[model samples]
Target: MHYKQLSQQIFKKSSYLCVGLDSALDKIPSHLLKEKDPIFEFNKQIIDATIDFAVAYKPNIAFYEALGPSGWETLQKTIDYLPKDVFTIADAKRGDIGNTSQMYAKAFFESLNFDSVTVAPYMGSDSVKPFLTFEEKWVILLALTSNEGAQDFQFEELQNGKPLYEKVIEQSQNWGSHENMMYVIGATRNEQFAHIRQLIPKHFLLVPGVGAQGGSLKEISEIGLNKDGGLLVNSSRGIIYASSEKDFAKAAAQEARVLQEEMKVYLDQL
Candidate 1:
């Protein structure tokens, strides 16, 4: 989807919520295991329940990849089953040499048909450029992440006294504009949003540290929002696995609605 269309969807839906479908098989209700394709079955019901409240759905590829070939099949089915208007993300965090990155881009954007894919920018511009070559598709380059390990490298001070994450955002803006590229700014890094906005005011940010990770929705919205509602706050365990019982989907919907309502207030304020 084009950036304008995505912005319209966020406003029209009164939400900037991205439901993370990190459907860990081991954590799903045991009753689902008896189904033909357990992972997809779980995802389908969750999508059905929460589609209205979410503008995007992100399935972490690692969860599906761990299941091997069957996992890949489940991932395909899950993508196919999602509502057409909602943005789809392949949280694959892929980055490699230019030639290999092109193949990876083809696999996710062309073959799987995801609207966007998470990318690791540690490999620099060449590694990230191939993904941007596709029309309208997005490259959500990892910037300041929520993980504790992010402190090791992303926070390291560089030549100009700016941390590495700040440098990543500054340099990446030259490769692609806000229209086709976004940065992954974890919600846990809420304090950094003000500075980040100064560095790249127009680009979208795919934030993924709310709810289960303890990132405050109110804090993120207060500091991170831009003129175009440039934030996609993702919640995984808090929504999808809200309840592991037979009514899991219903529970997921309830949780999503609550976030959407909160986002509605934030949008209105903007």
Candidate 2:
């Protein structure tokens, strides 16, 4: 999906919510295990329940990769089952040399047909630029993340006193336009949103670490929103694993609705 279409969806749905399918096998309800592909079944139900309120769906690749070949098949099926109008993200933070990155792009954009993929920019321009070559496929580069360990490098001040993540955002703008590139700014890093927004005023941000991770939706929404509603706040375990029983889908829908309602309030202010 292009930026304009995504923006329109946010307006049409009154939401900037991206439901994260970080569906782990061990955590899903045991009843689903009876199905030949429990993961896909779980995802299908979640999508069905939340699709009306959510504008995007992100499937974190690690959860499926751990399940091996069958996991991949399940992932493919889940992608195929998703509504085309809702954006899809392969939350595979892939980054490699130019040649390998191209293959990763092809796999997600051409084969699986994801609208975007999370990418690491630690390898610099060549690693990230390859993913930007595809039309309408986004490269969500990691910036200030929510993980505790982000303090190790992302916060480190350079000789010029700029934080590492700011440098990442500043330098990367040249690689791809806001239309095709986004930054992954974790919701836990809400305090940084003001400064981060100034750095890339129009680019979309794929935010995670809300809900279960304890990031405040109000704080992030207050500081992070742009005129276009440039945010895709994601909730994973908090929504998908809301219940481990038969009420799982309903519980997920409830959680998503809560977020979407909050998002609508923010959108209305715009």
Candidate 3:
């Protein structure tokens, strides 16, 4: 989807929520195991329940890749099941040499038809620029993440005295504009939102680590929202795994609604 369309969904649904489908066979409800495709079954229900409150659905590619061929089929089915208007993301974190990155882009944007894909910019401009060639498709570059090892390098001061992530975001703006590019700013890194926004105010941010990872939604929403509603706060386990029984879908809806309502209050203030 285009940025304008995504922005319209944010207001239409009163949400900037992005539901993550990190569905794993081992973790899903046992009852779903009896189904023909357990992982997709789990994801379908999650999408159905949270569709009212979410503008995007992100399926972490690793979970599906681990399942091998069948896993890939399941991922295709999940993508096909999503509503046409909602933004679809392949959380693939893929970035390689120019040619390889082109393949990755084709796989997600052409084959699977995802609207966006998460990318690691460590490979530099050549690795990322290929993904930007696709019209209206997005490359959500990894900037300041919330992982435990983020401090090991993201905070490393560069020659210019800016942290590595700051440098990454600053330099990357040249490769693509806010229209086709976005940064992944984890919700746990709320302290840096103000500074990061200064670096790229109009660009969208795909933020994870909100609920289960203990990131404060209030702090993220307060500091991260732009005039176009440039934030997609994702919650994976907290919502999808809300229950392990037959009530899983219903429980997921309740969790998503709570976050959507909170987001509405913040968007209202905007």
Which regions in candidate 3 have their CA more than 4 angstroms from the true location? none
Q: Which regions of candidate 1 fall more than 4 Å away from where they truly are?
A: none
Q: How accurate is candidate 1 locally (lDDT)?
A: 0.93
Which ranking of candidates, highest lDDT first?
3, 2, 1
Q: Which of the numbered candidates is closest to the native, going by highest lDDT?
A: 3
Q: How do the residues 114-142 of candidate 3 rate in per-residue lDDT, one tens digit apiece? A: 99999998899999999999998999999
lDDT of model 3 at residue 111? Answer: 93
| lDDT (Cα, tens digit) per residue for candidate 1, span 195-219 | 9978888888999989878899999
Sequence-dependent TM-score of model 2: 0.99
After superposition, candidate 2 runs with Cα above 4 Å error: none
Clashes of 2: 0
lDDT of 3 at 78: 97
